[model samples]
Target: VVKYGKWLVAAGAVGMNVLAARDHNRAEDVFGALEARCSDDPRLCDLGDGGAYLDPGTEALYQQSVGYDRRARRWLIGGETALLGAAAMFVWELTRKTHRPDNIPFEPEVRSLRNATGVGLRLSF
Candidate 1:
């Protein structure tokens, strides 16, 4: 169970990294497009008129992707944390020592010698 939890956490981290990288690339693509359209001076684009420098569709996609990335990151962190906690608990449970009831009966042995009999109790760890 602990091993599985570790794998789960690792997978989530990898997924989050991939998502972040993809979102960054998408955002960069939009910026590049805007820069090209504005002759490398995106700041000079019609800003006061509330004009969208980038294509409306692409901008919406970038915005949605960023929002999804943030949500995914938060969820991944939560999932990883939960999985690690569960792994710790599993390891602790497996390694912890517990007291058991002493239920073994003691056996006595009697041996007869040439002229005497001896009695002894047998015990084991």
Candidate 2:
């Protein structure tokens, strides 16, 4: 998860998905999925033909995500708040570097708790 966050930060800083994902595995996963689908026998399922569509879509989406990550770096969390948090973390780390204290970034907190409420949607036949 921390690795993902770091990747997102790089993407945000670089401001280009094609450039950012140049070092990311998301594109590899896209290609692997497309390859698997293309290689599958038609008797089993029809997959190869639509894969081209997915490729462009995946590229577009990855590019967009890169842009999003880049923009996230500009998040204006109150400087005072962030400074206080960083200060607290510095002191806390003095005690235990790996200790999880509280209010960790990206972990669910008050406002984000709304997102933790309703489950994600899924489709099933």
Q: Largest TM-score belongs to which candidate?
A: 1
| Ten contiguous residues minimizing lDDT sum, candidate 2 | 72-81
Best by lDDT: 1
lDDT of candidates 1 onward, in order: 0.62, 0.45
In model 1, state the lDDT of residue 7: 60
lDDT, candidate 2, 18-95, per-residue tens: 444443454455455545654663232232564423345444544555554444333422333444555555555456
Candidate 1 Cα outliers beyond 4 Å, as residue runs: 40-44, 49-125
In candidate 1, the residue pairs with backbone N, CA or C atoms under 3 Å apart (3 or more residues apart, or in different chains) clash, namely none
Residue lDDT tens for model 1, 17-52: 566566556656665665565675545454435554
lDDT assessment of candidate 1: 0.62
The per-prediction CA RMSD against the true structure, in angstroms, equals: 11.2, 22.4
Error of 1 at 29 (Å): 0.6
